[model samples]
Target chain A: MDLFEYQGKQYFARFGIPISKGGVADTVDQAVAQAEESGYPVVVKAQVKVGGRGKAGGVKLANDADEVRTHAGNILGLDIKGHVVKRLWVEHASDIEREYYASFTLDRSAKKHLGMLSAEGGVEIEEVAVTNPDAIALIHIDPVDGLSLDTARSWVDRAGLDEPARAQTAELLVKLYTCYTEGDCDLAEINPLILTPDGRVHALDAKVTLDDNAAYRHPEWDEFAGSDVEDERETRAKERGLNYIGLDGSVGIIANGAGLAMSTLDVVNQCGGSAANFLDIGGGANADVMAAALEVINSDPAVRSILVNIFGGITRVDEVANGVLEALERVHISSPIVLRLDGTNAIAGREILADHLSDRLVAEPTMLDAARRAVALAGGQS
Target chain B: MSIFVDENTKVVVQGISPTSQGLYHGLRNRAYGTHVVAGTNPKRGGEEIEGIPIFATVAEAVEATGANASFISVPPKFAADAIIEAAAAGVPFVVCITEGIPAQDEALAYNRLVREFAGTRLLGPNCPGIISPGRCNIGITSGDIALPGGPVGIVSRSGTLTYQALHELSQQGVGQTTCVGIGGDPVPGTSFIDCLGAFEADPDTRAIMMIGEIGGSAEEEAAEFIATSVAKPVVSYVAGVTAPPGRKMGHAGAIISGSKGTAQAKMDALAAAGVTVALNPTEAGEAMVDIVRKLG
Candidate 1:
């Protein structure tokens, strides 16, 4: 649900937010062309979902077309935070008289929409929060009342903005809130919203996180389908229509519920085993989803062993057991499996699994026993 | 006595038609003292679902059956509306079993429901729902996890984990007052802190078992509450210790974003506040029981 920088800029533009005009370039030649089109003094930014790109040399200021080509070539295949710089956004550089930070996101504590404004905006918001929490003005707006001009003005003033800048800042806050709600963004941040020497404010950068569940309502995202930016394991899982995310651990988990899957991951680490990934096949503990989940976990080389935990209530335990057996038969896997099955038809389910799994399946009476066995089979740290 | 549901609770199903996945099993839920007053599906109105009357609207169902709660098994897209309808109809509790309700929709639904009906309690959108031992089990979670009458009050973000944790507790001869899956959406209809507050006040709950994950400030908030209000022995664990940054682990809400919401941070916070930290799910029961015994 996180949009790359280029996509964020595009979305911002659609919302009438002013972003320095930029063009996405795939190759060195395209970057050079884009820089030339923008007429020198351009910023070449890597279009990745990660931060710290500037420090990683994924961002470069190009004075001329040649510099743009060089920087773009170097950054194109560069990896920063596990995301390759496959594309760059070549934008006309702006002259900043001052930089300010502004973002709108959900504040769970306040249990309302929150807008943050900082006088020192060009740096990481984390630094701002830690170093000078007071420098950042945090305002919570009731969803029903919405953000008003007066409230926005007070927030701007609280951020220590000058009177003239306060008016613009207030206006900008209202616009940003509109963009957040209407655009369905979980996070809409414009770091370093610049005030040009001419006294005009513009969004220099746009970071957006659109709700993924809203994708069905936006058919326009169809063109964004098959985006090559995702990790290979994620891409493969996506193709198989299974919910999968890769992690950096040795124990792979396959659970039926989201909450349980996360708990499984936590337990694995608590037991001195790191989880390689989080996989939830939902309520369908049947053979198809389980098989798909196993295949996805098997694709990760970091996974040394697999854990299958099911608390079948509406879902039949026997069905999940059959699915596990089906997955083992369909996919060639070398890792060991530790399974805990309970609930309706659990005895029958365990019987079915016992018949098929024999020695390969490590079944335990309780969750703790199962986790211990799985960790031990995978060569526990202690 | 159980917390949320019991033999006298009248339950209504949002999707009661044969087309739904758990309609037949919902009938079995009736045997546990769930009245199953009515099933809602406009298309199947006036028909009988497992002999339970079907109604077109939640209002009609609630009025006719005096249903205090609802169990929704509708598809994801329509689930939020069904929840809103249930709230409008004045159902005291609504348990939505549908998964993948859009986060925005959930946010909207939760905000509206909590704002409009302060008395109403909602369990899940992509969850297995809530169960109150012998009182009534409206969710799809297994029955064995419930031990007729237990003193432990459980609040979890995951349905399966809730059952697993309780099953472990039940095996140790620990009973539960009630077990609730608050759901795993980024914006849950009910939160762990909210349920923890209720569990803290319930005399039947001698100990509290909380399962959380790496997202938002829910765990941190719970920690603050536990530090201030909760007098009972609290045994807790936070999942997603190894979840990668940026990627949401399984659950939409189960991601370790910055430094604050990590499992390590949550565990540290809980431990600092005198809550026993279960190193893993396997150890949750023993840790909780030991804490309870020590408190006693």
Candidate 2:
């Protein structure tokens, strides 16, 4: 769940972090109106999830309404790293005396929440890390203890921030940490934590990644869900409660687990067939779930043959076989299905399917054999 | 002779009830010769599920049954608290089988486990729990495919892949000593290195098979550990070579971010560490067979 710059700013403002007044606009007229409300000299920034918006010319300084309209018109459809900008964030431009970088993210190896602060900002932090490592201050904070003001002040000092900006930056870091933990975010970053010539400090840009698992607690996250661009097949699969990813091939793949599903795709390619999609039924291979999965895969006209590969663990192969039978009866599938069953109760499951085998439905014993059969059915010579 | 669990390991089941997954797996574990001593459910205190008495708290269950390990199957919302309670109750090893726990909650729970319960090792909050074949079967892994006192030790990040590898090994008549699924979450309790170290120390375990996927540097770190510390023959298979970038592939941890956490990177690291990198699941099993034969 990556947030647009406007949404990230709104999220940060909830925690008392100061951000420039901004309005999101989808049209040139709306961008001009927003510039008027913010009193001109605005930054019409393209709202995309990808980085390097400025480098891609998706960001421009608008001194007046005419400039805002021109910038907005150019940036609205601009593509940065394959993401077409559909929205523009109009914010009052800031007068910055200095720029600094601050971010909070989980360090997987250290098993702690990592906070990075650097006096250098506005450029790639990775470049700073490689060239002058000492310019950045890295702190690993235990989630239980959290970020204390004392620790934050020391971190700011270690980063060699200016003396006058130290207190306000530390105060803002504490609030940002609150927004990170309390806001249920995987990452809360404020690039170019700007210091005004008047000695005021505030966040200039926000990049936040919210944790999807924490959606149960935050009902407001539905807005973010609404903005997600989903493929039709992916949307249908989500409605059916199946884990699916659409691909560009002829063989539709269905497996039991994530790893097995991925391996299924690889093996399908190995057997001289490309996979049309990756669908994992998970531990639930019941009748209703299987029917829904089959319907979703069958809806894809690109699929020439379906591969049902099940390696049962706690999930019984007999139950999955019964589900496959029930699903075959429910859905009017156009493509042939190649089934491979193994693990617990696999023998009985295969026996149940023996009576139902036909030209459209075939059963193979090993995964390799099933993949080969499915590839052959998909018009590939295996 | 086995790692993590054996005949001597007494188990306490948390979130056990007639309808809970805990009760279901707890009974199966007991059937596999594990000592299913007690259960804990605050509302169902003094009640019994399949003849196992339910206590009000983990401390009571631990005290009464002398349980050292805990199997947690509570819902995601209550999973962190359940783990905290088990760790606080002095359980040396806690395996949480619950998925979808908030990452923040897991972070706090991990901190508490490290600071308060220093000796306790949490296996997973979204994993198929550990299994010592014919000794103790914990969590949802089907125990029938694994054979006790076998020469191979298996560690995996995915559940069904573990089952597939186990099935292939069993079909080839190469049994296992202990099989551990470290889960597929971004932040797992036990790591590949942790399990690899245990397998390296166990004398009954002659060879090791590791299954990993794209995501995180845990596999890379484990490869480093295998190069320096482990002397046993190690075979590895990493999934998601055909997977696209920046997509979560069913598992929360199986996503490729930027250039890191790719299957190729992990395989390269393992191969550099002197591990046999298998191209597919069957190849991984065959690699294990070849290693076991050489050891014999």
Distance (Å) between predicted and true CA of A252, model 1? Answer: 3.2
Q: How does each model score on TM-score?
A: 0.93, 0.96
- Model 2 has a DockQ score of 0.77
**For residue B79, what is the lDDT in candidate 2?**
94
Q: Can you tell me which runs of candidate 2 are displaced by over 4 Å?
A: A79-81
Candidate 2 C-alpha lDDT tens digits along B28-132? 888878899999989988888789999999999998889999999888899999999998899999999888888899988988888888999999878888898
Best by TM-score: 2
Summarize candidate 1's per-residue lDDT along A1-382 as a digit string, tens digits: 7778788778877777778877999999999888888777999999888889999999899898788878898999999987877889999999888999999987766667888999898999998899889999888776756788898887898889755567887888888888887777889999988888888888988888887777777776666567643678888888878777777778888887776777777667667777777777877877778888888888898777889888886678989888888888898877888898887688998998776664467887766666767777777762
Query: How does model 2 fare in lDDT?
Result: 0.91
Colliding pairs, model 2: none
Docking quality band of candidate 1, CAPRI definitions = medium
lDDT of 1 by residue, B1-296 (tens): 66667677898888777867657657767776667778888887789867889999989998888999998878777888888899999998888878777665776777787778778888877777777887788877677657867689999887777877887788777788888888777777777877888888888888899988777778888898899999988999777676666667777677666765687888888998889887776577889877666656
Model 1, C-alpha of A278: deviation from truth (Å):
2.4
